[model samples]
Target: MRELLTALLSQDPTIEVVGSATDPYQARQMIKQLLPDVITLDIEMPRMDGLSFLEKIMTLRPMPVVMVSSLTQQGAEATLNALELGAVDFFPKPKLDMKRGIEKRADELIHKIKTAAQAKVKTLEREQDTPLALNPLSNIKFSTTEKIIAIGASTGGVEALRVVIKNLPANSPAVLVTQHMPEKFTKTFAERLNKISAVSISEAKHGERVLPGHVYIAPGGKHLKLHRSGANYLCQLTDEEAVSGHKPSVDVLFRSTSEAAGKNAIGVILTGMGKDGAAGMLELREVGAKTFGQDEASCVVYGMPKAAYDIGAVEHQVSLNKITEAMLNACGAAKDRHIRV
Candidate 1:
């Protein structure tokens, strides 16, 4: 697997694989000597595991690290944990015909590596206490007739969304999310969010009703849109060609929501790379939908939100910790309940 990755990365003109080691001792020696800018690590190893090593690296010599792991249940959980422990990003190691899968996903692999190289790695600290069950409110009111939330993220979105979604109250607006992720990882990512968040979360399905307190994530390789059906909105999934270099693009979702939900929608462009959602966010803003962007101080990449902010697409640029409350306020939720940033 390491050799395959090395060969793939070596083909990219902008990337060079500095060194490879089969064990932790050799890896430590190479890190001290070569002092590479980025590291691609596998979760499973013969000696010290990737998670343990990642914790050590963050504490001692914090730098950008992308995890390469299998697309299994255990792998998903461990990768999520690794993100909490300061890993920049992750890509699933394909299980089927290795050469064919690697070749097929070569562009995505190279893109992630480049994004990871530019990513800012922060020392993360996780709360060890058990999560308390949240009560779903029965009397929350929306300023508009219908309330909908659209979110788009990439790069550091795995951990960023975890913070934003987990902080939301149970009876918030119906959410539509576009996260640049692979097909196999979207389900796992949604499932992980469901376990941690107060509201239910799942991969979006065609014609599914958009209900309050539920979050829908766009499936990989497909575009997810919002369409009004009578008084309620419904999810519409399509196999449209990639927009802004991604299939389930933030631009597509924001534009669809802007057209379908109008001012009733809230468009949020979170931490990510590139300008996928910037133009769409401007459309949403023009149509009177409140829009927010993740502030630069809290962003992992700051590229996407900065682009949107530059075009006046974002109305309020808030920290990741304050975005949930800001969304609630936009939806007419009480202001006194705001969580500190």
Candidate 2:
């Protein structure tokens, strides 16, 4: 596996193939000696598990680290944990035919590596095991069910969305999220977030009514769009061709929210690589929906938000920690009081 990754990475002249390690201990030594710009850590390792090692790295010496994970349920969970521990990004390991699968996704791996190098990596502090509570937003009453929140993210979105969703009050408006992830990973992602969040969160099913106090994550292989079923909002899933180079495209969701909810919607573009949600966010903003973008300092990769901000799509540019508060405030669910997380 190391040989294959090295060979594959070596093919790209822009990326140098640094020293590879067979285990975490070796990798630690190599990291101190070589001090590479980016390191890709396999989830499964011999001496120590990737998550533990990743935690150590993030706490001790923060740097860009991309996790190479398997496609299994366990792998999905571990990858999400690694992200929470402050790893820059993750890519699933090729399941059946290793060589063929890796070769097929060669371009994607290269892109992730390049992006990881430029990512904003922060030192990770130990997180609380309990669910977070935001008192300022919790006390505000949301009278209407018409209000909706649409969010789009990729790259570092796992951790970004986790922070945003966990901080939301239980009575917050319905949230529709489009995060770039594989088919197998999205279920685990939603389930993990559901466990820690105040609001109910799950992968969106076709034709399901979008409800207040719930978060609907776009299923990985399908695009989640907003539709009006009479007075109620419904989640509409389509297996349409990839837009902006992604399935469950953020543009599709934001545009649909623009058409359906218009002024009643709040659009948030989070940390990611690429311009998927920029145009759709523009559409939402033009239609009077409030739009927010994660600022560059808070992003792991500022590509998507930067693109949106550049095109005048984002109305509010804030840090990641403040996004949930901003969204709730825009929805008229936050009081003047502030509670620091």
Candidate 3:
């Protein structure tokens, strides 16, 4: 597997293949010597587990790390944990036909590695066992069920979305999220978020009625869109062709929100590595919906938000910590609470 990965990565002229290690101990020594821009760590290792080594790396060195994980339930959970622990991104390891699968996804692996190299790595702080306290906005009673929050993210989205969602109040407006993830991973991601967040979160199902206090994540291989069914909103899932090189493209979600919810929707473009949501955000803004972008300083990779901001699609630029409050304030759900940009 290491040989295949090394050979594949070496094919890319832009990516330099550094020394490969047989275990985390060897990898540690190599890292100290080579000081590579990015490290791709496998989730499972012989001596020290990838997650444990990842924690140590984030704590001591704090360099961007991309996890190579298996496409399984355990892998999904572990990959999400790595993301929470400050890993930049994750790539699913091939399960069957290793050589063929790896070769087929060679481009994707290279892209992830390159993106990780540019990510703004951060130290991993110890997480509390308890869920975060509900945002102060929870005290305010939202008046209407008409508002919808549409969020688009990729690359660093797992952690970014967690930070934004965990702070939202239980009574917050319905949230529709389009995050780039694989099939099984989205379900695990939603379940993990549900455990920590005040709001109910699940992978969106086709035709499910979108409700307040709930978050609908776009199913891994499907696109999630908001549609008006009579007077109430419904979650619409489609297996349409990939838009913006992503199935659950943020562009598809935001464009649908623009058409279906218009001024009643709030669009947020978070950290990512592409321009998927920029045009859709512009569409939302043109229709009078409030739009927000995660500022570069707070983003691990400021690609999507930067693209949106550059095109004037974002009405307000906000940090990751304040995104939830800003969205709630825009929805007019937080009475008397003003978001200080």
The models' CA-based lDDT, in order, is 0.87, 0.91, 0.92
lDDT score for residue 329 of model 2: 79
Writing each residue's lDDT as its tens digit, candidate 1 over 1-341 gives: 88899999999988979899997778989999999888888888878999999888888888889899887878878887788787878878778887888888888888888888888887656554236343233335555437899999988898888877886666778999999877867888899889877789999999999998899999988999999988879999999899999889999999999999999889999999999999999999999999999999999899999999999999999999888778877886743365789
Top of the candidates by TM-score: 3
What TM-score against the true fold does each predicted structure earn? 0.91, 0.95, 0.96
All-Cα superposition RMSD per candidate: 4.1, 3.7, 3.2
Tens-digit per-residue lDDT, 132-218, candidate 2: 554455666765667899999998999889888887788889999999998888998999888877789999999999998999999
TM-score (C-alpha, index-matched) for candidate 2: 0.95
- lDDT per residue, candidate 3, 70-163, as tens digits? 9999999999999999999998986788789989999999999999989998888875633446356567677677999999999999989998
Arrange candidates by lDDT, descending.
Answer: 3, 2, 1
In candidate 1, stretches whose alpha carbon ends up further than 4 angstroms from where it belongs are 128-145, 334-341
CA lDDT for candidate 2: 0.91
Model 3 is weakest, by summed lDDT over 10 consecutive residues, at 128-137
- Prediction 1 TM-score vs. true: 0.91
Worst 10 residues of 2 by lDDT: 129-138
Model 2 segments more than 4 A misplaced: 129-134, 334-341
* Better candidate by TM-score, 1 or 3: 3
